[model samples]
Target: MRTKSPWLLFAAIFGASFLCWKLALEPHARSSGELERAPATAQVDVPPAPRATAPARADATPSAAPTEHALPPSKQRVRVVVRLAADASAVAALGAELLRVDERGREHAVACCNDPLAPAPVGPRELAELLRAQRALPEQREATQRFELAEGGRYAIAWHAWRHVPGTLTWRTARGAGEVFELRSPFTCEERTLELVIAPEQLSLDPALDAPVIDAVTHVTAKDG
Candidate 1:
């Protein structure tokens, strides 16, 4: 028998090697590429969540202004003292009132005869060039506490006018005709006692030529707080 050629044997070996690479090595490389690409495409997208925060704070309440008038009221006593010019002449009072004064010296009616509890007008008054500017209140009716006395021989009479808060206050009285009289000085609310002194000249005729004239109105005090 003749021996096989060396060249044919080499060709047969190369052919078998090419077949194994195509069937096994190429198929495994394709499968690995598909697996890697599948993992990347299957990922899902998600959104981030929001953060929490606190709300703002506010004030509890607002402030207010002061009020008028006082609390826990008290009573006031009034006394009247009159002097006659002579035995023949006489003196008496028709009505009386109490007035409260402010820093501007403006007068406010605290008590009146017709309406004893009338409140003072609330507002600024027109300014004038007087030591104490007297302002006219709206629909302002003349007020009095109550003064009923006769021109009898009696020299004085004592009565009560009720509550009178003592800040800067004075008394007003009707002299005779349309005459109006006020106390000389303002009084504090301490003792709250007002003693009105009427002179003889105010009630009757004038005194003698040489006689000295006295004050028209005056008030006496006991003690103060």
Candidate 2:
């Protein structure tokens, strides 16, 4: 171990082959160069996948129809009752006027009785002394009027008087059908309960006239209940 100069046995086999390639091939080539620069495991940007939707169909489209003076079919609630007889001292005071005719003949006065004892006299002997002081006293009376009618058709009631009175007018029908009229003195008559055919909740009327002055109408139907 002392004659070693072949350059110290080639420098002890070149320092035991560089210390066994730095402990086994430089620790597996420095762990494959630290798994190639160890930082390539940071590459994230993944998102893409989603699409689906379809549903809705059932025949749809249709609406509009109603107009022809499209408003007049709602009115029902009628009640009228009137009764009067004459000869109460030759009528010394009395008055009445009520009118309502429709079927296109249009004329609606409604109701009134007494209230003109003056302001309407220009002559004719002061309107025959105001119609002889409105019949010098005496009147048998009964008058009840309530109105509203519009539900479906035909209606009429016309009674007039300036003198000469007698009365009776009735209307009923909810199915009982009973219309009576017996209004005398220039009332003339063709009968038909003064014309009526109403329908939709039913008819109603009552009128009385016993002259001194009278004009009347009765027909009804109303609603709000």
Candidate 3:
């Protein structure tokens, strides 16, 4: 008799294994309906369905959205313009000081500027401009300062000016009777503008040329929306 081939023996073992696996999966596939059959009777297992969650309580409350009213007060930009009038051709910038006042009638010097003042030399054309504007002397515009002011804050401006005589083209560094513009401001709101003018006629300046009076017209406006 001829001996069995090694290839024939391997084929017999594979056929027996395939038959055992088919018999074991057929019973579970029919009863549970979980295992699915694909092409050529390939088995595929299916997972169980997820459980349902319980409903929320009827007494539960929802969250609310934020509003603009919850924001803090914003700061405002403050601009102060100062102008001086005299017959002099040139004037030196004596520096201006800004004061921040507390609620208890106390003042604090905050900001200051030493920028040079502008000069207006007199001439035939300048005379015409002065005559057209109905002014006795050419107005000397000085440097401006900007600061950030808070809401519901109090402030004052104390400026120093050098002494100069009217109709004289000379400007000296000798300072005279300089006064402070004490302000009880109502800047609680950000929508306020002020224009304060102190002319020659409004003040009784010193007769002596050594001590000239401080004449200033300050215009402050809020630069905020």
Candidate 4:
């Protein structure tokens, strides 16, 4: 066999090594370029989180409807004339209070009329103040004069008689409805009469029978004939 030349053998080995390095390096460079150029994965649009909401309440109360109505004109009036009488032997003066009573039995004083002997004007504000003061001083005197009644509702006539001696007083409506009250000397006698007045749209009581009549025991007199 002929011996191979040393130079030729060396040259062959060097060429093979260079070829292997080129192949390995070229693949690595290509892989790096591919990574740099690859489009960034489309940023997935993350939807915003939903907002929190409050739950509806189960026990909320509904608003109430108004219960007040307009009052009728003053020209359409329910005249309430009052008369008082007593024994000729006695001297007396009578004052009256008109009240509105609701279905619930709550009393609202609507008007007050004083006898000519003790005259004073009592309005809604004055009556309210008197009532408040009465809680603190039950014996306080409240002065009042005649007032107009406009609205129709259940009403009451409270009469007070000032007399010189202890006695009894009688109260009656023109319709024959009546009540009695006891009087004390030096102090006033008080009585109440309840009556219903129909609305303007309905039949009303006879105007002639709409007055209140009061009578007292002997020795006492009434200012109003």
On TM-score, the candidate that comes out on top is 3
Clashing pairs in 3: none
lDDT (Cα, tens digit) per residue for candidate 2, span 1-225: 577678787878998888887778664457767766633211111121121121111111111222234442344223333223232122212222224445566655443222232123421123334345444423424222343433324333322222322232211111111132222222111211222222211211222221233555655668633
| Candidate numbers, best TM-score first, in rank order | 3, 4, 1, 2
Single out the weakest 10-residue window by summed lDDT for candidate 3.
Answer: 55-64
TM-score for each candidate, following the candidate numbering? 0.22, 0.17, 0.32, 0.25
Q: Give Cα-based local distance difference scores for all models.
A: 0.29, 0.30, 0.37, 0.33
- State in Å the error of residue 205, model 4: 33
Q: Which stretches of candidate 2 lie over 4 Å from their true place?
A: 1-100, 103-133, 140-153, 156-225
For model 1, the stretches where C-alpha displacement exceeds 4 angstroms are 1-88, 91-93, 112-192, 204-225
Candidate ranking (lDDT, best to worst): 3, 4, 2, 1
lDDT at position 190, candidate 3: 38
- Poorest 10 consecutive residues by lDDT, candidate 4: 54-63
lDDT of 3 by residue, 102-207 (tens): 7786766553232222122322223223233323322333434554555345565434333333444333332222223333223222322322222332122234
Clashing pairs in 4: 89-219, 90-219, 90-220
Q: lDDT, candidate 4, residue 97?
A: 48
lDDT of 4 at 61: 16
